[model samples]
Target: MVAERKTHPYLSLMNSYLIDSPQPSSISYWYNLGSLLGLCLVIQICSGLFLAMHYCSDITLAFDSVEHIMRDVNYGWLIRYLHATGASFFFVCIYLHIGKAIYYGSYRKPRTLVWVIGVIILIATMATGFLGYCLVYGQMSHWGATVITNLFSAIPWVGNDIVQFIWGGFSVSNPTIHRFFAFHFVLPFILAALVVLHFLALHTHGSSNPLGITGNIDRIAFHPYFSFKDLITVFFLVLIICLFVFFSPNTLGHPNNYIPGNPMVTPASIVPEWYFLPFYAILRSIPNKLGGVVGMFSALLILLFLPLLDRSLYRGLAFKPLSKFFFWLFVFNFILLGNIGHLHVEVPFINLGIYCTIAYFSYFLIIVPTISTLENILFYLGRSNK
Candidate 1:
């Protein structure tokens, strides 16, 4: 049996990583998210490939091409909705996966590379999603592409050049659509590569559990136990996606997107897809164009500093009262920021967005380190006293 296993290198690798690999017995449903994310990526790539076969990147025909897919091609509508709704679910899983990492201090020490790679993957995913959003060439799609690309103009002296470069000309035109479509097609393959790196970095240290303890002593194989467990969640995901695809496909999408793109007219509200609202709110919160651009990107890049910012003596928030409390508050603030992004930029909403933006940064920069240091002191004092 050993000789036979050794004869097949790929099967041996599969057995090592999946069938015989050991996982913490205490790991719960949260760990199931990583597998779901892999599933989501496969769904997106497959659905997108089929859509690409019929998609036209020319600005004049892009909108019509989308309509043709919906009306003329059999089951094209199903593929379109699956691609659309699958993006949402992908973000949902990623956000949950990130949240779980934060709560469990998965960025500590040995796993810092894993966390860094994950952040890069998030940025890449957002860019790909934005590019795909612009491919439709609808009212919202056109204006959204215009508005977002224009943000690059906030850069110093060369800002306008950057915007023009992104546009592939002076404006979002035929070249822009072609470029965006090309990029939108290519980025998922990059994301897949990054995800593989993320997996390698993770498996080097193994998974971080809720309790933040080493799982070496209490471990179980990855076969029937977690494999079947992951399948259950995949089934549930399929059911949820089916309901959305069949019953209410457009509920998560903007109605403005159904109309053909008109450079002459702008939508009443030029907003991105729901997944981007929090960062979009951060961008809108700042009054200055340059400052807003900086703030928006800083919100994402700051995530890379987590392993350093968290000066906790131990991993996970399970034992730290203050850290856990502030963590939940941070999550609430993020959701609030998303809501603020959805609203029109007015007096009250503007102020609300600004406050949320401050809180969002405060959570990472101030609240985390402060609470962690204080907790470390209290823990040492308590032990010494005992």
Candidate 2:
């Protein structure tokens, strides 16, 4: 039960954010993804703190430390599995959250700050995940770190210097692992702060609804209404996470990572985690070293321009049939990029990756503005004829 209003500052703030805040009455299950994401952030931070307690960041002992946690420490395996599985699920929830925002035009106008902070959070989370992955110091972890850090060398003048700065040396070594562990440990706290900012920005204008209309006319308290509804999705999320943690712990991981790091031998195929597949595919699609690097970063940075690019008179895609259709097609193209990223960069796969990269950028650059403008004209024309 929500407590009665009081003079205490903490209680008053809680009332503002949780108990008394108004939410759209018509908002559906998609809105629940935000709460799910918050839960995921908490799970990751707690488990990672515990894992770090016994983890040794030295390259020689890093792999062994992970084994010690799994085989020697008490319930360490559960914590480790939870952290790993939670990383994947975090991306799942965030991707859906971004998709919901786009579908409802939540990034437009007053809510642009919220959406921009979210994209920054996405970038931070990617960095944190990459750092954590390297802390394992297994075969895949070591080589993956080497490969990804080397991407910085594609720059024109100071690229090699930047790579060296990141490695703390000429290559991935003892100092590199040590630095990664430190950054991996620190970034989550920054991520948590960013999440708080995201909430503040969102609450400034309240939540968006399905019909693309103002939510003020029909609103409900967040506490007992949608808070309980959020629990429904949380239950399903926990069920799925548990299934992965206990039944199929390594299903999302590479087998090569099980072996200890070896500088002399390289995995025949080195790929980032599955969550990174689409962008990784974009990176590989370009033939030139520098071009691929620019293309990959552009793919992410382009999302920030959505608010300006969408020229429609209204928010949300519910009334825009053409925009809705193209949105789903864009989703398909993204999935295709991820699929291509999993294959070897040769023959048909290279060609396929190139085509998908083009489609991916075209959806934002050309399709969105054109479709939005066309829909605006049709809306007025139909009204006049009626």
lDDT of 1 by residue, 287-336 (tens): 99999999999999999999999999899998888899999999999999
Q: Give the TM-score of candidate 2.
A: 0.98
TM per candidate comes to: 0.98, 0.98
Candidate 2's C-alpha runs over 4 A off are 1-6
After superposition of all CA atoms, the RMSD between model 1 and the true structure is 1.0
Model 1, 221: alpha-carbon shift in Å? 0.8
Candidate 1 lands at a TM-score of 0.98
lDDT of each: 0.93, 0.93
Q: Return the clash pairs for model 2, or none.
A: none
RMSD of each: 1.0, 1.1
lDDT of 2 by residue, 1-386 (tens): 34555456778788888877999999999999999999999999999999999999988899999999999999999999999999999999998999999999999988999999999999999999999988988898899999999999999899999999998998899999999999999999999999999999999999999999999999999988988999999999999999999999999988888999898998888888888999999999999989999999999999999999999999999888899999999999998998898788899999999999999999999999999989999999999999
